[model samples]
Target: MKLLPCVYLSAKQDPTSKQNLSAAMKAGAQCHGLWVANYGNQQTNLRPWNRDQIEPANPVPCKVLIHQYAGDIANGLFDFNQINPFLENPELVIKRLILPPA
Candidate 1:
C-alpha cells in the first residue's frame, strides 16, 4: 500500500461526515495525520502555541496535526490555524507527517 497524507473534513457535529475515511483507507489512502477543524471565538493576531488548547467537539478518527481554530477572519477573507498542542514534538511531528515519504 502507498503512504498518503489525509485530512479530516471537519464538521460541526461529525468531523468525518464529508467522506468515507475508512473506505478511502481500504481503497489505499494512507492516513499519516489529520487536519481537524474547530472554529473558535477569537479572530485577531492568532499564532501557533498561543491560544489555550481547544479540541474539536467530535472525536476524530486519526492523529491530528493542525487545528483550524477560527474562521471568517477579515470579513470572511482568512482562517486561523495552529499546531496540535498535544503532540510531544509538534514541529518534528508535523514535518514528518507532511513531507513526502522517503
Candidate 2:
C-alpha cells in the first residue's frame, strides 16, 4: 500500500517534532509535509502548504482523510514501542493510505 507524506500543523512550538516525525516515518509514513498557519511568519512559508491550500492547485488522491496531525496514531506507536506502528493501526492508518503518486 502506498502512503502519503505525513502532515503537521501547529500553533505552538513542539520540542518533540523530530521524534514525532521519526516515529511516523518508522511507522510507514512515506512523505513529510508541513503546514504552519502563523500569520506573517515567513518561516512558515518555507514549509509546504496544507492540503487545503494545495488541493485547489494540486489535488491529493485518496479516499479517506488521515489525521496524523493529531499525533493520535504516531503517539500510540511511539508509546507502544512498535517498530511498525502504522501496521498496528491498520483500521486507522491503512484505511487512509492514498494511491501512489502519478
Candidate 3:
C-alpha cells in the first residue's frame, strides 16, 4: 500500500498563498496532495478556488485532500476535517492517496 507524498499547509504559514506552494516545490518536495490546516470555520465545504486554481509553477499538480477546518471541537481535543469535494475525479483521487500512480 503506497501513500501519496503530501504537504501540510498551515494557516499560520498562509496556506492559501501560492508562494508557499512554490517554496515547497523549490525544496525538492514531491507534493501530490496537500493537507491544509486552517481552522477557519466549522464548515465542510471546499474552498472557492480549490477546484480550478492550478499553479503552473508546480511540476506535479497537487490538490487539497484533507482540510483541517475547525479545531477544539470537543474541549480542544479534536479537530474537524473534510475531503475536497470539488475535485474532478474523486475516485481517482482516493486511489492516488493509497496507491502508486500507473
Candidate 4:
C-alpha cells in the first residue's frame, strides 16, 4: 500500500487559510486534496477547497509513497528505537536534532 499525502484539518483550523493549505501542499501532499479528520457522519462535514492547493515554494525530491498508518491505531504507544533506523539514513540531511546533546 502506498502512503499518500493527506491534510487532516480539525475544527480549530480556518478552512479558508490558503497559507496553511499551501504549507501542506509544499510538504508533499498528494492529489491537492485534503481529508478532514474526525468528520464522522454528518451532512455539514467540512470539505477541502476545490481549487489547487498543491503549489509550494520548494519542490520535494523523489515523490515516492511509503507505508500507510492510522493515528488512532497506535494511540499513545511510541517507540523511538523503531523509527531511529529510518532517521539514521545517511541520505537524510539533519535539520535540527530535538534531542539533548550528550
Q: Say which candidate scores most in lDDT.
A: 1
Error of 2 at 92 (Å): 25
Order of candidate numbers by TM-score, starting with the best:
1, 3, 2, 4
Q: For every candidate structure, what is the RMSD over all alpha carbons to the true structure, in angstroms?
A: 4.9, 14.8, 6.9, 12.9
lDDT (10s digit) by residue, model 2, range 5-53: 3353432435465455556566776642333323322231133434442
**Model 4 misses residue 2 by how many Å?**
11
- Provide the overall lDDT of each model, using Cα atoms, as 2-decimal numbers: 0.59, 0.34, 0.55, 0.30
RMSD of 2: 14.8
For each candidate in turn, the TM-score is 0.54, 0.28, 0.48, 0.22
Ranking by lDDT: 1, 3, 2, 4
What TM-score would candidate 2 get against the native?
0.28
Point out where model 1 deviates above 4 Å. 1-4, 13-19, 45-60, 71-77, 93-102
Model 1, range 16-37, lDDT digits (tens) per residue? Answer: 5434665666677677666666
Instruction: Report the lDDT of model 3 for residue 64.
Output: 71
Please identify model 3 stretches exceeding 4 Å from their true place.
Answer: 1-3, 14-28, 41-61, 71-77, 92-102
Residue 15 in candidate 4, Cα distance off native in Å: 5.7
